[model samples]
Target: MSAREPLIVQREVKPLDFLAAGETASEFKELLKSLGIPTDICRRASIVTYEAEMNTVIHGGGGVMSLRLEDDAIIIVAEDQGPGIADLEKAMQEGYSTAPDFVREMGFGAGMGLPNIKKYSDKLEIDTRVGEGTTLRAYIFIKGQREE
Candidate 1:
């Protein structure tokens, strides 16, 4: 309850698990709501969670999603051990997805994952390496402190 103590929540993502993906996103939204987070912030967080979850499922081949609540910000971190992105620049572009045929056929990978995450989160950081995997950290400002 104090600024010195932060709350963290995490969930494991499975490769291509559509049902679990939805569940994880919903759980995050509900958790945020129960914590008295503003509805708008909750929505933004959920959108970011869903996009990051999808990327983990469809492209990362499984990973972990975590949410951290601090006194001034909400942080979401997604980590994966799958093959890393070769081109960060191209991956950030909208409509530029590396999803395979089946993933696209599932109506999920339109290459908007990173773009949507950026749109909803106040700040985003991506650390990626080919063949190594990636770690994405997204922050949403709260309590009117948004200079980061």
Candidate 2:
């Protein structure tokens, strides 16, 4: 195995189904804790995961978000269908949101989702195609330790 390979543990959840508003963040935090992840890291991971899950529900009409806990990193993969991002750069910018009026009324369309995920993660990769779908893979590294 390569040094860069992640020893991954994966979990897949249907958008809005497995993660409802009141339980998503807490469930994720618990999962991280069960895996021996630190509290601070769990908080960041939960935030990022929740944002991605909401995006999948609101924009993609529901999809799957996979969480992977590796030896030295945490990886989150969110995949969704149709209405791929038109401008990734613009989407990554804070406060640039295309959320519907309803979502905006719900006070969640500040366009900080992607930017926040990128901010808290060590690496973020987004794959999207117009009229098709999008896939976002993010990695958060464990501090002060290198995994072989």
Candidate 3:
């Protein structure tokens, strides 16, 4: 196998699916812990994953979250078929939410999802097409070196 080939694993997040929601991110966090990743890095990764998963569940309509484990970093990719973000800039702002009132009632749609993800990820990129879909790629360096 190529050295660059990732050790790939993934999980699906479905809307209103209580049984499996957020499980993927949780498992990813545990895997990172087992691999001896630093506490801070692991926590950041876990938080990012959860936020991304919530976005997928609440906004994406449903999607898949994948983890690509590389020697130097862990990559998170969240892809969904939900309506693409209409305003990327607005969505990035803290406390800006498009989630319905019911989701907010659950104390989850505080509008911190993208902001928190960006804060914790070493690198963040988003690809979205309104009425088509959205994809988010987040990188977390595991080498104890934070990117400036």
Candidate 4:
């Protein structure tokens, strides 16, 4: 991780890969811990990572998840080539979910992904197209930089 290059960790997420679901989040959290980031921020980043990872797996058909540690914040980016979210507003609602029956049966998609992501991250941005794909960027500002 060169200062000029920035510290970024990227991982590929496979569709329906329940077995590997939370791995990226766990690894990212560990990385944060190793860097001595605040516990709360680490937890928040992990939450964002897991939600993004799950969404990529269940709906994205596969994509890339990356963690970029910046001078003032930790950024989590999830990008997928799967069908994009048709209704962005509805998907932001806590109980709205497009996950299949099997996914719900497995105790995964209870909706809440975007809602929780919005809650945890200080800032969130999403760029999506109907057939192209979706890219979500969530930022957790370091201490002293975040607003109350």
Candidate 5:
């Protein structure tokens, strides 16, 4: 006998969600908790999801965030249809942002999104095209959590 696995959960990130992106993170936190994911992994996943969701709202035009729980890891995929990152290397830098003044005024887009996402996730994959779109895949394993 084995414990039941959690079902896949997907949420659409509309431009409007930008006004309340924090809610997105909250939603994931609650869902992961309900699914019995380890606290550390859930925290990491929440951070990555929030960052990725913000990127979609601020840059990706619009996208979808999907989550799945595996026996050993949590998988998150954020896909958006918007202008892709021109320079992946440059974009990966912390505190580097291309957000306009309005977005900046909204207290988002401080350029820490990608860097933070990479920092917390065990594995990450980013796919983008200049004019096509972008897809980010992040994984957090459920073992060896560190104390805060």
Candidate 6:
């Protein structure tokens, strides 16, 4: 199938589950392929999804990620109930992480999580409130028009 085909898949997952991260990534890849997403674009989408999932697990304390596949775009919404980000601008900067020491020991606390998500996604929107939670919505276009 090609990206022009009509196919959509959606899934909800709990945060911090051991299987949540890898499972979500694999499902996203399969869904993209099933929907006729090009291989290259699927790879990019998978990467972004994985990063978002990880954030939901490690930072959000727990949350849900929902994905929608459209003929020309992929939309992912990741929500979490952890401490909200204090500074969105600073968080978007590369190499600024707040991961705890344990996560750092796992070799993923370099603070590049949010930056990487922004880098791989075509459009990113984050909504967060202190002591409330956070929600991240990202969009990736399959055959979107480019401005001159």
lDDT of 1 at 101: 92
**Model 6 pairs whose backbones collide:** 97-111
Candidate 2 clashes: the total is 0
lDDT of each: 0.86, 0.75, 0.84, 0.88, 0.83, 0.77
- Encode model 3's per-residue lDDT on 1-148: one tens digit a residue: 1124375677878876544656777788888888888878878888888898889988998898887787788888888989999999999999999989988887878999999999999989899999998999888998867753
- Give the per-residue lDDT of model 1 (tens digit) for 46-116: 88999999999988989999888867789888899989899999999999999999888989899999999
**Tens-digit per-residue lDDT, 17-123, candidate 2:** 52373366667778889978888888888888888877787677677666776777888777888599999999999999988887888777789989998887788
Model 6 segments beyond 4 Å from truth? Answer: 1-15, 145-148
**CA shift of 33, model 4, Å:** 1.1
lDDT of 2: 0.75
Error of 3 at 108 (Å): 1.7
Candidate 1 Cα outliers beyond 4 Å, as residue runs: 1-5, 145-148
Better of 5 and 6 by TM-score: 5
Winner on lDDT between 4 and 5 is 4
Top candidate by lDDT: 4
Candidate 1, residue 77: lDDT: 85
True-structure RMSD, every candidate: 3.7, 4.6, 3.1, 3.1, 4.3, 5.0
TM accuracy, model 3: 0.89
The better-scoring model by lDDT among 3 and 4 is 4
